[model samples]
Target: MPATRPPTPLRTPRRRPKKSRSRRPRPPRPPPPPPSESPAVDPENCPVATDAEGGVDNAILLPDDPWTLNASSLTLKDASYKGIVEVRTASGATKRVLKYVISGGTDIGDLHQTVQDKRSGATHHVQAAKGSLSTITDGDTVMYTESISGNLLGLIPITFDPEHPPPLDIPLIYFTKVTVKQAGQFGGTLHVPGLRQYITT
Candidate 1:
């Protein structure tokens, strides 16, 4: 009877399968903040003061008076030198010679040579003018005189590049001063007494 119980059928063993690994998603990153300072400063905004001769600061005289030159398109030749020349736009405002022009035709004579020459025998002499010239070239800074009584009208500076020729279409500069003519009745006219021709290189 014991041999008969041992004769039971043999049982088969079951095994569990291995699981596959998976990657998890990562969180997104935030953007960086903008820079505080500017990349570069403009040269016009930061005008440099120089002591060298013929320097822009030394040549250009900024008038202390609140008035300015009238430089509308009607008055100015171009917008490039609009703010270069400073003048008072009041009646009978006297402007002195600030610099001299070597090549261009200006009311002011050669000032650089005159300033350097101490000998009275020298024929070259510099004389000051009451009215300012309309056209100013690359190295010229002349005084501006205001003849008409008006508010701060405008300030204009006209420069000619040595490399380029004068514009045939438009006049270089035309300065207008309101004056009363002694006709039967008082009349007004724009007197551009100091219009200079375009000086070619």
Candidate 2:
């Protein structure tokens, strides 16, 4: 019987394949974008509007710096904050006020307030001997005006916290305008972004 090739030699079955030992590769993800930068605070580029009362009206920022006061970038007059006053009434209530001077920074400067000649429409000058601020006022408050040494103009820092919400000491600043009224018309306006904006971050 044709040597039936020696009885088929016994052979081991191939080992069972490991159940899909490998997995499908994953998809790649997209990279993140760069952070956005805020534009510099400028009347032209940023939000600058006048209030019904006029004077740098209010250079306010919203959504961002919802509490921001002053135009940190206000360089129009180049005045510096001078001092603060805390007012306590007979009712055990208190208030914080800020003072700004037209001149007398580092060395000595000529601080003048400018107002317009209502009838003549000519620019008038009122020297600012000094400046001061009363932090909380539901509306604009022009206080303690005095003549500038030798000028006829009346001077004082006109300030307001429209909302007037407060800690009193650190009230929510709204807008500030330093005025040098020659008589009726406005002479010039100064920037008062409040203490927070004035300070370096």
Candidate 3:
């Protein structure tokens, strides 16, 4: 205990210059307000412009007269890229023109659907079957469908594209009951197919 004189070397505590909290330079965060042009939906004006088409997430089922899908069967399993569309028929005088080169993807779970009737030129085909397949019947999603003839009226109300950016649901339906192989008939051409999809999440 007589060596107390050696304790004088412990006075090296002079590091008090760390109070740098004057962070007033953080105002550069305002660049995020420039990405909204306002029309993520409801601006097609409606001449029969159903919805769900924000850039690359399309799903416009345009049903002004024939849109009955109470869920009999429609499963898509996630790889994205669905198909079924029929535009050009609202006073434009029936012009269902859809062409696809495919080039890749689309025989995974089955449902490559297509339908065309460009003023009776006639063209139809159907698909659905790789796992599940049934495709609606009767009623239950609210119930409303009765126009196999005359003055039709159904579907026509889907508008879902608020900028369409979510967690990879990318048109991933994954499965449907079964039966849709036209010509000789299996599903009878669900209004002549018009559901072109492209999901790659």
Candidate 4:
């Protein structure tokens, strides 16, 4: 036999080593862009207009403050304010009246408000020697006319649960010719985003 040589020697197969999966480090992300600035609350930006009631109206915006009435922002001249008023009659029933115009005043830092009765055609006005408009409450209540001291005019309930709407019959005051006062002491610095004027039909 061509020499079936010795029986083939047993050969052991070599095992290959497994490669480890090493993750590569990711590149760092870039910084975000800065926030955009809001438009200035200037009358030049907000032009004057006339409302349906034949009253001239003007307004400006406070980009920061939505509530707290900024006393220094308003420059009311021969202007008036109209809003909804809730009153209790002698019959012990609540009633909401409209066209409750509070107007008439010659001075800027003076307390003067005039109201006219529709039915009786009579007018009533009040003026305080040493006082300024404190605030415009959410209820459309103008405080500081009679009393000079009080919390900053709260435009709305400061704290409320958004999930559950608060039981508030918040009223709105439509002002006429509300111009921005000079920017100095408590002027342009005090920002109130609330509506300076609203033209109602």
Candidate 5:
């Protein structure tokens, strides 16, 4: 009988260790540029006035002109202030003033200034068919329109019902509206430093 030969054990192969990878350091990035600043405004040019009695036909409103805005609706940029609409009137021995802060960005809208009688303390809202819709700004945007009486015409804010109202589907019809407080009218002044010019649409 031949003796059984022992089977030789299979040898397992050994794996070599992986080499460590080295990464290069990256350079630092540069900072971004600073924001632009608005042009300096002269206080003398601020609070631009539009007088019906005065010979001045129109007062130009500019962003560079510095004017104080008590209230603002939109976000201000370039160190610019908000915008406002003010009307003053003197009838007999009485005087009155009304102010409305401009809001809702640079969309042309109607701003109605309630006219009042200084003598009787009675208020009146002028209704007219023809009026100039001036663009009002305060270094922010052309957001509103003010009705100012011209040489041969009177510009007054047109009113509408916010609840049950007509369709403002007309191309030129304004959807935004603002009603100012009561203001007496006796050959007074309307100071709109933000009033640039008449809006085409």
Candidate 6:
């Protein structure tokens, strides 16, 4: 072989590495929405009285009679205070009076003061025992009667204008129901009469 003087060093060709098509990155997923504050109330699982859309009636229940009560003249005996609250209708065709007795370990004077304060638009937080008896009249004659019982502290009666006449005969209904599920949460459903169904999940 003819001595080819040392062959010039061959130049290695540079090649770019292949991109990884098999390991493509995935797009990120969107975040979920926040939970609702007020849940819907299912009608089938709630009371009939709560069938109303808003779960309560907007109309105020005013007495049909006009009468006044003097807490000063009332007697607080046996840890209970007894008094009368009167109402009069605009047409003078109806009159209603509600007799109530609030009893508990607390003093009746304190209860009276509390009630008076509420009537005067004063706010005080105290728990007490309370009950009421509702009596209605048509043209100055007693027509209907009903009893009221509940947490005394939660019962706040708002007086109606003497020029406005409330319903002559209003229906009174009391209902209580409880349901327990295996789920790890508490929920409530209310079907208010003449209103929308409400559910809390």
Candidate 3 lDDT over residue span 56-130, tens digit each: 111323323322222233332222322333343223322222111121122223344444555565545444443
User: Candidate 2 vs candidate 5: which has greater lDDT?
Assistant: 5
Query: How does model 5 score by TM-score?
Result: 0.19
Clashes of 2: 6
List per-prediction Cα lDDT, in the order shown: 0.29, 0.29, 0.30, 0.31, 0.31, 0.27
Residue range 49-69, candidate 5, lDDT tens digits: 555433222133222211111
Candidates 2 and 4, the one with greater TM-score: 2
Q: For residues 1-201, could you state the per-residue lDDT of candidate 1 as single tens digits? A: 444545668778766666767767677677788778866977765644543322232233333432223332223223222222222223323232112112232221211111122334333322222344333344332223222121112243333222222233232333323211100101122234344322111
Per-candidate TM-scores read 0.22, 0.21, 0.20, 0.19, 0.19, 0.20
Q: What TM-score does structure 3 among the candidates reach? A: 0.20
Give the per-residue lDDT of model 4 (tens digit) for 150-191: 221323222222222224322332222222111111111112
Kindly report which residue stretches of model 1 are placed more than 4 angstroms away from their true locations once superposed: 1-8, 16-103, 108-139, 142-145, 148-201
lDDT tens digits, residue span 1-201, model 6 = 776788799999999898857966778887888886886888776764632433322123333322122121122122211222233333333233232222211112211111123245543322222332221212211112122222223243323222322323222211111111100101122111222222222
- lDDT value, residue 116 of candidate 5: 35
Backbone clashes, candidate 6? 25
lDDT of 1: 0.29
